[model samples]
Target: MENLAKKVRSKKLSTRVDLTAMVSVSFLLIIFFMVTIELAKPKAMVLDSPDHGCCDCPSYPDYGENRSITVMLDENDKLIYYMGLLESPIIAPKEIKYGKDGIRRELLKRKNSLLKYSSKSLKPESIIVIIKPSKKSNYGNLVDILDEMKIAEIETYAVVPEFTPEETKLLAAN
Candidate 1:
């Protein structure tokens, strides 16, 4: 009877699971993944100036027929565009709305015409665009116009700060 009591132990054993290492490994894996993730890059445009460095006088581009287009960015997403110069326009200045139907349509037409003349003896630098922004025009308008220039695949374009007096008068009357 003494041997049987000795065999049967009185102390009770408890079991515990340690989850500290598991949590540490999980956090490390999360940090590793977070650090390795790649972010999307922003879109940008490249602008080139027209200076050949021959003379001190900046050679002004000739405003020829079917060679240039002038766009005026006005208030409330309004665009006034004309071909040639601000004085004697190829076509008189016309007001148009933004988006696919209005400005985009005009641009596409001009692009198609330019493509047509490309097979002819036309200079590659024939299409020069002058973008004049009024004080009333917002930054969003400028971005949209730049985006449109990209969409149109315009080779050369310049952003002039202020419009001419005549252009301002035309906008006021428009």
Candidate 2:
């Protein structure tokens, strides 16, 4: 009876030993997986500009390919208040003041034009308002323009840097 009890205790010890090896292997696998995991990288959009010695001009895309509206901010950071499609003649600021009401009215006019052109197609959720502020422009002006764009429902937009392609290329080359 003493020998039989000893044998039973031995069996229990063997089971416990087997569980220790499995737990150790599981911990090693968790550490290996954590070390081998790759972190996500940030994404950014690249803008193509002209090479060296090129004139300072915004990259003009093919006409009517994509509907875009350009709003120029002067040295004072005030809006030029133009009401026209990209690459088309810009209406002078003297004709329209650079106020919130004026911007809202112009946006509505553009929306009306798009509706007339694509009556069967789905209405655009937002208009692409490209802002190009002068180098000497105030930062507050840019913020104001963004706020105005949001209020006018023309929130989908891009900001063109004041430096031209040639300028950027020169800086890069130097």
Candidate 3:
């Protein structure tokens, strides 16, 4: 019995736990978390403003009854003017050139047309110009158009984003 007890006590039980599988699982979990996480992007905001007393207000109308003249700047910085509002047929300027003088000439012609259509006592202030520049349009061309609008004495102008309703909603939500 003493010999048997000695043998039993001397024998060691092997119980080694392998950590390789655990380490691999941990690595896979880390990789999955890194892959699934979404990075945030910066966005701009649009706000509704009262018609009379807000600075930096969006060019959209409150009652949807205001007159708006839309001018489009294409990807090539080409100026395309539309009289009236959105969904109106795009009207081409008499001449197509990418310069300040050309824009001024076109604006003058448009002003004259407005005068011809309206009563002689009406001022150009009744018209609201809306500039719709393409995403890839040249900044310089936009500046030129702005200058022309100023020269034409158009004070109530708006810069509208060239986006669809869904895109606008997405942007607004963000």
Among the numbered candidates, top lDDT falls to: 1
Q: Where's the lowest-lDDT run of ten residues in candidate 1?
A: 38-47
Stretches of candidate 1 off by over 4 Å are 1-65, 122-126
What would the per-residue lDDT of candidate 2 be over residues 1-174, giving only the tens digit for each residue?
Answer: 888777744334443345888899999999878866733345443434445547765453433423556666655444554435323445432223455567667876876676576677564333566777767668777777777776776645667866556333333342
lDDT of 3: 0.60
Please identify model 3 stretches exceeding 4 Å from their true place.
Answer: 1-67, 85-95, 120-125, 164-174
Question: Which segments of model 2 are wrong by more than 4 Å?
Answer: 1-66, 81-87, 90-96, 122-126, 163-174
Residue pairs that clash (backbone atoms under 3 angstroms), model 2: none
Candidate number of the best TM-score: 1
For candidate 3, which ten residues in a row score worst on lDDT? 86-95
lDDT of 1 by residue, 52-167 (tens): 68659646465565677888988888899998776777777888887889877887788778767775755544467788889999988988888888888876788888767888
Could you give me the TM-score of model 3 versus the true structure?
Answer: 0.46
- All predictions: root-mean-square deviation over Cα? 6.4, 11.5, 12.6
Better of 1 and 2 by lDDT: 1
Please give the distance, in angstroms, between residue 10's alpha carbon in candidate 3 and its true position after superposition.
94
Worst 10-residue stretch by lDDT in candidate 2? 86-95
